[model samples]
Target chain A: LQGTVTRKWDINKLLYANNIEPEDVIDRVYNRGGDESEEEDIEEEDFFKKKIYKEPSNEFDSYKPHFSDIEMLKNKWIFDNNNSNIDKEDSAGNSPFALISRRFILSKKMIGEDDS
Target chain B: MAKPSNIVFQTHRNFRIRLILSTLSGKPIKIEKIRSNDVNPGLRDYEVSFLRLLESITNGSIIEISYTGTTVNYKPGLIIGGQITHNCPITKPIGYFLEPILYLAPFSKKKFSIVFTGVTSNKQDITIDGIKWGLIPVLEKFGVRECELHTIKRGSPPNGGGEVHLKVNTLLSSPLTLHVTELPKISAVRGIAYCTKVSPSMVNRQIDSARSVLNKIGCEVNITSDAWRGKNSGNSPGFGLTLVAESKKGWRIFVEDIGGPGETPEDVGTRVAYQLFEELSISGAVCRSQLPLAVVFMVLGKEDIGRLIINNNQIDSHLVHLLRDIKKVFGTEVFFLPDDNVIDQNNENNSILTVKGSGFTNASKKIA
Candidate 1:
């Protein structure tokens, strides 16, 4: 309103624009908002929390899954074994006398134990 | 013991006869079809009659025995057929089981007849009807050469198990009498110790050493491993190293096995020795085109030795004595081989190595 047109607003002017007393706002928002307030009943909330988080009748909830049910694959044991069908085919198709003869000649090579 | 004599003769039908024989420890002589007229004029007729006849003929004196085909008189002429049975003593007829047959279909899961002659009987003929034409042989491809062709009798009774029994007689053309006084000499040597926990490399080394020692002493060496083997739990693994060599004297073979591995080395070795001789004997029994000479297993480094002697005609009785003597000489040093007792005490040192019997209570020593 002055000839210089100063822009800064005083405290009284800011308080009037908000349309509420500073004392009344502070008393409602901070002073009366503790646990003691009837609207903020934290103890009743804590009772319901305890009931929801309570343990079920079963005790081994974490131990439900079996170790074997989850598989860890291993390839050596599966692939390294001898082909039994091929062995059977060779024994049946090949000449027994020839096999015996070969065995006689290369006996050192035929030293494997008959486990399978 | 005197060597087995050879029996030979010629039939009027141009068929030749020869029997090289010895007495078996088991069965005696039994003849099926023969008559006094069939016997030669001045020949003795007890044991080894055929042998004596052949011997007399070979003695630079000609003694001939005549046999005629059983002829059937027809209006046009006479015909002769069927089998002719000759009587002679055999060591044992068991040698016949070793005959090798031509297996047509190795995977047929069925055994067929071993036909040596014409397809005259239903029991001997094998027909592969459903099989492809490529599988069966043509007329000219039959097993017999110069065989008389006969029409195939179609409706043959099913050979229950598809196996047929047959009898074949093979005559020698030039029945020469060559006395095989000495058998294929087999040197009996101690087999290597088969240890349960020993590595294969170790066994190989032992075999090599044993072989070198044996060969240095003029024993021929043949090293062969077994085909099948199981866990050597309380027993050792035994095998034989046969050394076959030729010298100025004759062909000689030496064999030894240290029995263990479920069976004793000697057990397996002796069995193999018998089998080799049996094969030769069977060849003699059938009188196939080729026959193997006798096999002798000479036990070395030990006073006691085991011998399994088989000829064309019989398994010798001296084999038992020879085996017994071998054990008595070696004493307890070698156990698993055919022995009278488990622990031989005659040799104070018990230096000769041997395998414990199958039922050995003491745990086998682990040798590498």
Candidate 2:
């Protein structure tokens, strides 16, 4: 009975209620994935791979994290929970460090839950 | 008691939240970098107008803006409530200004009678109807009675010339503690499909489309269609729909959509109804938009643990920032407990947010 109730209320029904098509959700997810990947690429090129030191103007500067830094922190939380070795070389022949750096970008494709 | 030092913050994010906290805590604050990177930046006219309104209600308040308008130093004064008239800027709807005022009105030194003239409903912010239908009851939940919000004129965006009157009486001696953990069944759905300086047929189209979407969900909706013309209508021509879903427990979920240049009336109606349906589907005490207001009141209420179940997805940056500000100003901590049931994992978007109130009491009491 629970399964029947669950099946009765499906994603298509939600989409219909919201006046959105399945294609729209697909397009939105795809576009979000693309944007995340592009942002990760930029972060990898700028912050992690090459550490450029900048002068801090305010006392609170140390407490503030960059967008890329926040992304890295979220990725680290997921990685620590998954018990994935950070130093292991991936099948793509990328070094462990390189894989860790791009972990957020690569993991983006695996998580497809709708945030709406 | 030792005087508290000033709190310094950077950036222009959540300006209203910071101002509300400062006013309630009676603490001085310095905020720098008000949209510094943007072109023609540093405190828009609307923000300055909001500050002026704040000044009108408070006594001995000190506000200093830098020459570039990139920084502000504010020292809050005693909240002295009385009759006041404010012309809100056209950039924002009257709801934006009314929200913080509602939060502060109960604790005011006297009765408050405010006349606000501006845009009543718009796409960007909450509408006046939502506040009257949704938030007023939430205020009453905290033991506040005799508060009224009435719309004298309906206004839309751009060329706004709307008017709304708000009157809130003094609050109770002790703030009532609230605990809304149980999900209540939706009792009824009410809405207003309003159009001004537009075709009367547009309102019917909106109502029909909205009914089409809501009637399918086994929820009965009673919608009132309103059409204003001539001098009563504002400068702009537009139509919008505002829907409020009331639960058996008296909590409300409010949703609104306004038609603009390209959007059709049918789209506005369907979208607003769908949004309301999505909100109703969430098993929580309050709607997503009311989360911040609830948290703020919880901090200001009598000393007791207030617990609420809210959707995890509804947590926004503004709510997070408000939580942090509460910690800094009131020394109160908020905890989030995620639902851990594996069986309900597929449908569990609800999380529990708990906080202890600071037992704040209004300084001025009415004499019998």
lDDT of candidate 1 over A1-116, digit per residue (tens): 43332233222222222233333222222333234243232222332332222212111111111111101211110111221113322323632222222212222223233645
TM-score of each: 0.20, 0.75
Per-residue lDDT tens digits for candidate 2, residues B78-159, read 8888999999989888987888888788877888999999998876567888788777878877878789998888888889
Off by over 4 Å in 1: A1-116, B1-96, B99-171, B179-206, B215-240, B248-250, B254-258, B261-368
**Candidate 2, which segments miss by more than 4 Å at Cα?**
A1-116, B1-3, B340-347, B366-368
Error of 2 at A34 (Å): 10
Error of 2 at B366 (Å): 4.1
Pairs that collide in candidate 2 are: none
Model 2 sits at a Cα RMSD from the real structure of 14.7
B141-183: candidate 1 lDDT, tens digit per residue: 2222221212122111211111122322221111112222223
Worst 10 residues of 1 chain B by lDDT: B72-81
